[model samples]
Target: MSVTLEKVDLSLKYTAYYKQVKEELFEGSSDILNAQRSKAFQSFVMQGIPTRKNENYKYTNLHPSFSPEFSFAHSKTEKEADLQEIFRCDVPQLNTTLAFVYNGWFSRKSSAIDQLPKGVILDSLESISKQQPELLSRYASLADPEEDPMVAMNTAFAKDGFFVYVPKGVVLENAIQIINLMEGSSDMFTTQRNYIYVEEGAKLQLLLCDHSENQNNYLSNSVTEVFVGSNAELEFYMLQNQHNKATNIHSVFVEQQRDSRVTTHTASLHGGLIRNNLKFILDGENCEANMYGMSFLDKKQHVDNFTQVIHAKPHCVSNQLYKNVLDEQSTGAFAGRIHVVRDAQKTNAFQRNNNLLLTDEATMQTKPQLIIDADDVKCSHGATVGQIDEEALFYLRARGLDEGKARLIMMNAFAHEVIQEIKLEPLRERIDELVDKRLKGELARCHDCSYGKDC
Candidate 1:
C-alpha cells in the first residue's frame, strides 16, 4: 500500500493543499500574516523539495519518502485513545506545564493547560492569530525558505503549532513541556509552525518532545522561530523519539539581543530518518550561545545534525559540541559551521564533533567548518571518528571487570561530555538511564512497532 509521487506531481499537490487551507480553514486571518504565507508558498513552488544535489543536504536524501497521496492534516483528527495517560513522562519529581499537539494540530480537548501564569501566554497558533495577530507578525515566517528549501515548504503549509510569549521582568520557575504526538489511520504529511518571544529581562525554559504512535509511515516537517530580547535568557531541550517508520525534518532559528544567553540540547535516541537544522544569530554585543547534541543510532537508522552559529557583533562567545554513537549498520552525519564577520572583533567561537562506532559496518561522516573574517577573533574546530580506546578498555578489564562492563564504562565516558550539559538534574538522570540502556542493547527493540514500552 505504498504510494510514491514523482517530483513534479508532488509540487502540484502541495500547491493545491495551500489553496484549500487559505480558502477554507485559515479564513479571516490578518492581512499581514496572510501576505507572508502567500509569499512563502510562492517560494516553495519555485523550489520544490530538495535533493542530495544541494550542498547542505548532500548527506541526507528526501526522495525515497515523498508521498503526495498521503493526507495533509489541515484540520484536527479525532483522538484514537487517551493520549493524556499514554504519553505522560515517567521521570519522577519533575514538574512542568504540559501542552499537547496531535497530528500537527494543537489539542484543544486536553484539560492540562486550563490555566497559565500571569505574565505568560501559551495557546494554539490559530487562536493567537485571531486574538494577538500583531504579536506574531514579527516572528512568524522569520526563517526564509530561499536559503533552505525545506523551511520554505514548512512555511507554505504551516497552519498551527504553538505560540508562547513571556513579558519583560518575569521568570518562570517550572519548565514548559510540549508533547507532539503523531497518530492516524493512514500515511499523512504534518507540519508545525511555532513562534516564541521573550521580552527584555525575562527568563524561561522549554522541553520539546516528539513521539509517534501507530504503525503507519508518515512525514513530519516542523519549524520554530525564537527572539530573545536584551538581558533575557532561554534554555531549550529537544528529544526526538519516534518509531522507525517515521521521518522527521525539524528546524530551529534563534535571534539573540545584547547581553542575552541561549542554550540548546538535542537528543536523538530513536527514529528511522531524522534531520535537525539549527541556526543561531548573535546580532548584539556580549551575547552567548551554546549548543549540544547526541544521537545513538542502530539497526540501519539514519540521523543528521546541521548546525550554524553566526557571530555578527563584537564580544560574543559561542561553543558547540556534538557526539554520535552508531551501532550495527546505522549511519550518522554532522556538519557544523561557525562564522565570524569582519567587524566582529573579540569574538570567541569553538566547535567539536566526536563519533563512536560499535561495529565495522557502522558509518559516520563529519565536517567541522570555521570561517573567520575578523583578525581579533579566536576560533578552533576538530573532529575524531574511531572505536573504543583499547588501552582504556584494557585498563578497566585488568581490574577484574568483565568485557561488557568495561566497554560500557568507556562508552559512558565518551558520551558524558555532551550529557553533562543538561542543566536540570532530574532530566539529566533520565537521559543517563536511557543512554545506559541504549549501550546495553536494551533499547534496541524500539525500532519494532510491536514493542509497547515507553522508549
Candidate 2:
C-alpha cells in the first residue's frame, strides 16, 4: 500500500504565525536580500512537503508528524536553572559546549568557547550571512536537495543556525560541541541550518547533541553542510536524545578534497520518529571517509538512517559501520549506498550494518548496496539482523555470572566496536554510560529467555 501525503491543517492562530515569518523576510531588509528570500520561498512552495514515496524517506513514515500544522516558535520558558537541570539529567560533564537554545538561537551564556583556537570561526547564521555572504553563497549554492528532500526544505526555511570555519593550517586543540535543545511547549515548527568549512591542512572535531523537554509532538527540521579542503581532517559526532514525542528530520552533507579525512559518529537514543540523511562526496584523490552510528530504541520510537558515499575521484577510501538495538515495539532502519564512478579507479569502500532485536515485535530493515563502474576497485557490503549469541551467553552463565549481568556485558561488547571509534576519552565514557543505562533497562524488562534466542 502506498502512503498518502496530507496537507497540514493549520489553525487561524498558526496562519498568522506563518505570515509573520514571511513579513520578517523583507522587514526593512535590502531589496537584493528580499529578492533572494522571495525566490527561496517560492522554491519551498513549489516543492511543497516530502512524503513516504521519496526514496530517502521510504522507510520513515513522517505524515503523522507533518500533517499537523505548527507555528514558528521564538522563545521558551526555560531558564538557566532549567537548562542546568536538563544538562545534569541528559549530559553531565558540561565541558566544551556550543548550544542552540529553543529552536535556532545560539546561547553564549550556556556554552564554553575557551578551548577554541585562533582562526576558528563560530558564529550564528545571521551574522555569517551578513558578514560573509560570499562564503554563504559558495556553500549554499552547492547544497542541492534533488538527492534528499529534507535538505531542500531546510535551505528554503533557514532562519537561524551555527556556522564554523577553520582557517588553513590551524589545528583545534579541543572538540567543538553543539547542543540543540528543542522545547515543544510552544506551538511552532522549528528549522535550523549550519555551514562548516575546514580549510586546507586544518583539523577539527565537533559534537552535536539534540534534546527536548517534557513537551512532545513537535517537529525539528535541520541541515548541516561541511566542506573539507585538501589535507584537512574533521571528526563529527551527533547524539539524539530528544523527547519521544518529537519528530526529527536531519541531513548532513560533506564534500572532501584531496588527501582529506572525515569521520562521523551518530548515536540516536530517543525520538518519536526520526529520519536522518547523511551524504559524503569525495571530490579529490586520496580522500578518506569513515561513518559510524549506534542507535538504541524503546517503546514506539522509530528511527531511520540513510547514508550515501560517492567516489568521484580516483584512489578514495570510504568505510561505514552502523549498529542498532531495538526493544519493545520500536523499529530501526539502515540504508547505505556506495557509488564508485567510472574513472574512480583504486577506490576502496566497505559498508556493514548490524541490528539486535530484543523483542519479537521489534523490527529492523537493513540494506547495503555498492554500485561500481570501475574495474580496479575494492568494494563490499554486508548486513545482519539477530539477537545475542546463546552459546556465548551460556559460557558466561557457566562462569557464575548472573543472567542480567551476562546480557549487559554481551550488549556492551556488541556496541564496543562503534564506541571504540570515539577518540575523545570523555565523550567515549559518556557514550559508555548511555549504553549501559539502555542495557540495564532492557534487562529489567526481559523475562525467561536464553540469550534472547527464544524471542
lDDT of 1 at 370: 88
Listed per model in order, the count of residue pairs whose N, CA or C atoms clash below 3 Å is 0, 2
Itemize residue pairs with steric clashes in candidate 1: none
lDDT of 1 by residue, 90-156 (tens): 4556788888888998776752565667969877887787687888775535588888878888876
Which residue pairs collide in model 2, if any? 71-188, 71-189
State in Å the error of residue 170, model 1.
0.8
Error of 2 at 421 (Å): 0.6
Task: Report the C-alpha displacement of residue 243, candidate 1, in angstroms.
Answer: 1.2
Q: What CA RMSD would candidate 1 show?
A: 3.2
After superposition, which runs of candidate 1 have C-alpha atoms over 4 Å from their true positions?
Answer: 1-25, 28-33, 78-82, 138-141, 444-455
Work out the TM-score per prediction: 0.93, 0.88
